[model samples]
Target chain A: MKLATIRHGATTTAAVAVNGGYLPLPARNLSELLGTPEWKHLVRVATSSHSSPDVIPRTEATLLNPVPAPAKVICCGLNYADHILEMGRDLPEYPTLFAKFADTLTDPDAEITSEHSQSLDWEAELAVIVGTTLRDADEAEAAAAIAGYTVANDVSMRDWQSRTLQWFQGKAFDATTPLGPVMVTPDELDPEAGVQVICTLNGEEVQRGNTMTLVFSCARLLSYISTFTTLRPGDVVLTGTPGGVGMGMVPQRFLRDGDLLRTEIPGIGTLTNTVRIRTRATIQSV
Target chain B: MKLATIRHGATTTAAVAVNGGYLPLPARNLSELLGTPEWKHLVRVATSSHSSPDVIPRTEATLLNPVPAPAKVICCGLNYADHILEMGRDLPEYPTLFAKFADTLTDPDAEITSEHSQSLDWEAELAVIVGTTLRDADEAEAAAAIAGYTVANDVSMRDWQSRTLQWFQGKAFDATTPLGPVMVTPDELDPEAGVQVICTLNGEEVQRGNTMTLVFSCARLLSYISTFTTLRPGDVVLTGTPGGVGMGMVPQRFLRDGDLLRTEIPGIGTLTNTVRIRTRATIQSV
Candidate 1:
């Protein structure tokens, strides 16, 4: 089953994709639905009845991020061996974790402004959405905690990221994380198996790699992170991206205004965003 | 007037601190009360009714974090001139911004376990709680955005913090940010004026400094941070701590099992937490 968050009027509504259409769920947001077992059961029922005429057309509706306002947006660093080598870093002995706040989140179609940052770059990553509250879960338990998978563009500012010891300063600029067209449940694809993840700028492929390169699998990541903190129902874990980030390029290709960024994972969906520079007056106007 | 979140039964209630006690507010949490015109009115009423009989005894109930789940928890790095010198780094040209998820938050008397980390440390910081939604606000507008002030202990793990270029991993361990006892409204204290802030370990003074040591004032920090992203109601801006972090000590004093951490500020309240180490069985048990 594919789940999504769609904008209906001024508010966001939980939805499930079915036969080229979307069925609005009786919930407010993904986080609220995640807290109830009944919601998951209802999603299965809704997906089974997708062919019925009661389904709403997916078109003519605006799509929001699949996992909006997650309690925690956790990210991993150097999970891919090739990417580790590209940045001249050693293979990490343990999974490196970081976080992005809800304010930095943006929808797939949202604009990523390059304001105050001239070295914006893109990293294509596979994001796992948590279904249940998990803490100190073992391997099997961690595997069961995963709800679905989605695509994310870990847009970063290279200059800012390198300025300090903490990468969050550079990684959490406004509208930095472009996430989701839809969330594809594990039944749709093998959660452990590798899948193709790619990124393109202005219709030109800039980064291409496979999830098979991940040094730490999803289960290990979930388990490792839970050791330090409790994983909430609506938390998101972004498995590290494979090689081919803009920083890996010889000349270091940075995102510029009007650059179209397309990030995708095979079974999930595509997340496309355009870069724009925010001016001081324009920012003040918001 | 001061504000706090109280757990009454299964629900979290927002309360106004009155003389010698508190008065329950109409809101559920600080986040819900922010940005409401009625909140300002409530503040006025609460201030005038400080000595009223309706005020409830604070000892009769539990006090939770002032802002349990803020829209964003923005943190600054080495923003104090003394801290910069202690860390042996040059002064920063801009306000360094990073973030922590809402899940990392806990109340004033909450227990903070450093089981997963062997080098946990404590940082006493003055946090600015946002009252209004602010984006690219000028200095004046930034000052207007402040709703109140609170004391926070930004607990960290040095090893995890230095694991990557991003400090989020070490900064966001579960139950790390123990905030509040009360949030003193702007009318009660001048944020720009320096205030005494201190921290102690096991009843021994470890840090003592004034907000005057801050390289950037509260107004400048808020205005600068808003340039990178939108500051929403109930959002918190943690102005950086001073030079006496445990990691900066000559012999390096990391938190160990049974260590008691107490942090306090002048107008705001004090927070106390005890640390416990994580064991293998403990990880499996959870």
Candidate 2:
């Protein structure tokens, strides 16, 4: 079953996607819904409806990122073998971890506005959302903690990222990263068995790889992060992206005004976002 | 005027530090208080009068970290010149920023409980709390954005930190970083001119430096960070630490059970936290 956080007019809430329509769940957002002890059971009830109100036609509904203000948005770097080599780095013995805040999140269809850099780049990734609260969790416990999967484009500012040793400044511009079309449950996905993850800009395929090639799988990353901090419901983990970034291109095709970014994973869905360079007037007005 | 978040039993709220006792403020936390449009005016009134029912005595108050869950907790990697030299690194032109979550924060006087690594290290820093929202702020705007200053120990687990290319894993263990006793208003400080920052373990001075020697001043950091993200009320900016981390020591002294970590700034009060190693039995019970 596919779950999403959607809006109609001013009201936003979690819902189940079905038959080109939405079945509204009785929760404020995906995070709050996942926080309940009976979330799994609730989702079961949702799939088998008790006359769920057709909240809105899915086409007319405005979909928000599943977990907008997650407790944490942990990201891994250099996890994809080809991507690692493309960037001229070795397959790391350990995950190179970093973070992004809630302010950095933009909706699936939102426009990417660059106020800091002209070198905005894209990294398409298969993302994970945690469901249970676990600390010092072993591999099995970590596996049991899986809530679902989603899509994200880790839109980055190449100039800022490379300026300092730490990549945070370049990666965390407000409302820059796109994080969801919908969340597909783990039972519907075997990403570790090689699910295709692809990125395209202006109808040209730039990045293509399989999750099976991930140096560190989702379960291992979760268990490793849990060793240091508690992994709670609504926390997001962005598994690293594959190769073919614009930075690795010969002339370096950076994002410009009106560039289209499309990311797709077959079982989950597609995310289409247009890039718009904030004009001098538009920037000054804010 | 000094503002604090104090807990007595189950309840916690923003309060004014009066003579020997605290006066409860209308806001729930420092974040909410700072969010008000007339915060400066409100604080002016708070400092003057009203028969405020006596809250906890200042000395007896059970203070929590001033901002329990800020929108962001950004930490600097290397800002102090002398300390930067001690760490065997050249001066950086830009601030090396990283992140920590609310889960990693503990009360000022709380015990440092570690369930993971034994190579815990100390990094004493002067912390800034943002009061107003700003984006691409200039120097003057940055100065106005300052809410106040406080003390923090960016305690790290060196083993976990060095295991990976990124430093986040080791820096973000749950309940490790100590953030506040109270927030001292900017009107009371000359941070740019420098304020003495000292760190002592078991009453022996292990690290000492002045905020004046910071490679990036507080106002400059605020302005620089505002370029990428909005600086909201209660967001914390840890201005990095001076040199003298345990890793730089001759034999490398690491934190152990019963070790006392004390941090002090002349304008801000002192923070004393004791370290404890959680046993395996205690870890599993949770």
Candidate 3:
């Protein structure tokens, strides 16, 4: 089943996309819905009622992040062997983990702006969204913890990232992570299977990779990160992107104003964003 | 007035600390209270009703982070002149900003642990908690955005921090930031005035500094960070720590098992933590 959050009127409402439309769930957000045991019941009901007329039209609403304002968002670095090789860096002995605060999250179609440095880059990744809170989780437990999957564009500022040893400084600028059109639950798709993840600039494909190239599997990465910190319900794990980052290209390809970035993954749906460069006066005034 | 979050039964409740006791507020957490326009009214009521017998006593409660899962927790690097001098680095041309996920936050008396690295360190900093949602705020507006001040110990793992260019890997381990015994409102204390901030190891004073030595004042730091991201209600800014971090000492001092860290500021209350090192098997199994 595909789940999502949509802006109804004054506030956001939990939803489940069905047949070409969205059905509002009887919950506040994705976190609350997952916390209740009703998800399993809902899944059972959904299968049998697949042909029911309870579906709401999707054109009447605005989409939000599937799990807006999660407790944690863990991101991996250099997890793709081909990407690692392209950067002239050795394969990491252990998964390199980092974090993105909830505030950095935005809807897939949201606009991103960065004036501090104009060297913005795009990375298309398959994001795993956790369904249950799991700490010290084993592989099997990690698998059970996963609720669904989504697409994310890990937008970064190259200059700010290289300025310090920590990528977080450059990685966590406000509205940097564009997540979700909808969350595709594990029952609907096998997360371990490779999917064609692609990043397109305007109308042309610039990045093409598959989850099959990831050095660490979803379960292993989740378990590894849980050892360092707790993973709460609604938290997301962005498995690292494959080779075609704007920074790795010849002469470099940084994001500029009016550039549209569309990232898609099979079964997970598409994430679209537009780039807007901050003006000098706006930068200084801020 | 000072604010805090006390876990009562299953839910967390907001409270205002006064005299020798705490007065329970009608809000769930600091963020909720700040989001309401009645916050100033609530403060007035809390202050006037301090001596009223109707004020209930908080019983058997566990204190949570004063901010209670903020929108973001922005941290600065090398914002103190003395700290920059000690680290053999020049003063930053701009405030170096980084972030800590909400999961890294622990209560005042929580335990800090490390699994990947053994060389852990402690940094006592004056944390500014935003009272109002702010974007593109000027210095004056930034000062107005501040809700209160608290004591935070920004724990670090030296091995991960120094081994790479990005300090985030080491700076953001689980339970790395212990924030608050209570938040002292701006009306209660002047952050610019010299307020003795101290950190004691076991029972001996190992670090002593003053907010007066901060290279960028709270207003400037807040204003500078706003340029990068929107500062929302309950968002916290960890102004840089002064010199005397364990890493800056002769031969260097690092945290080990059974070590106790007690950090305090003049107006704000104290925070105590115990450090524990995780075993290899324990680390892997998690």
List each candidate's DockQ score.
0.45, 0.54, 0.41
Best by lDDT: 2
Model 3 global lDDT (CA atoms, 0 to 1): 0.80
Which portions of model 2 miss their true places by more than 4 Å? Answer: A50-55, A279-286, B52-55, B278-286
lDDT of 2 by residue, A173-278 (tens): 8898898888888888978888889999999999988999999888888988888888899999999899999998898878988999999888988889999887
Q: Which number leads on DockQ? A: 2
For each candidate, the alpha-carbon lDDT, in order, equals: 0.81, 0.86, 0.80
- Residue B268 accuracy (lDDT) in model 1: 84
Docking quality (DockQ) of candidate 2:
0.54
Summarize candidate 1's per-residue lDDT along B67-129 as a digit string, tens digits: 877868888888888888888999987666677767778889988876667778888999999
> Could you tell me the lDDT of residue B235 within candidate 3?
86
Clashing pairs in 3: A165-B165, A165-B166, A166-B165, A166-B166, A166-B167
* Pick by TM-score: 1 or 2, better one: 2
Candidate 3 Cα deviation (angstroms), residue A282: 6.2
- Model 3 C-alpha lDDT per residue in residues B179-203, reported as the tens digit of each score: 9988888988887887777899999
Best by TM-score: 2
Candidate 3 local Cα displacement, residue A70, angstroms = 1.1
Candidate 2: residue pairs that collide: B83-B243
Candidate 2 lDDT, B95-192, residue by residue in tens: 88999998888899999988767788999999999999988899799998899999999999887788766788889998899988889999888788
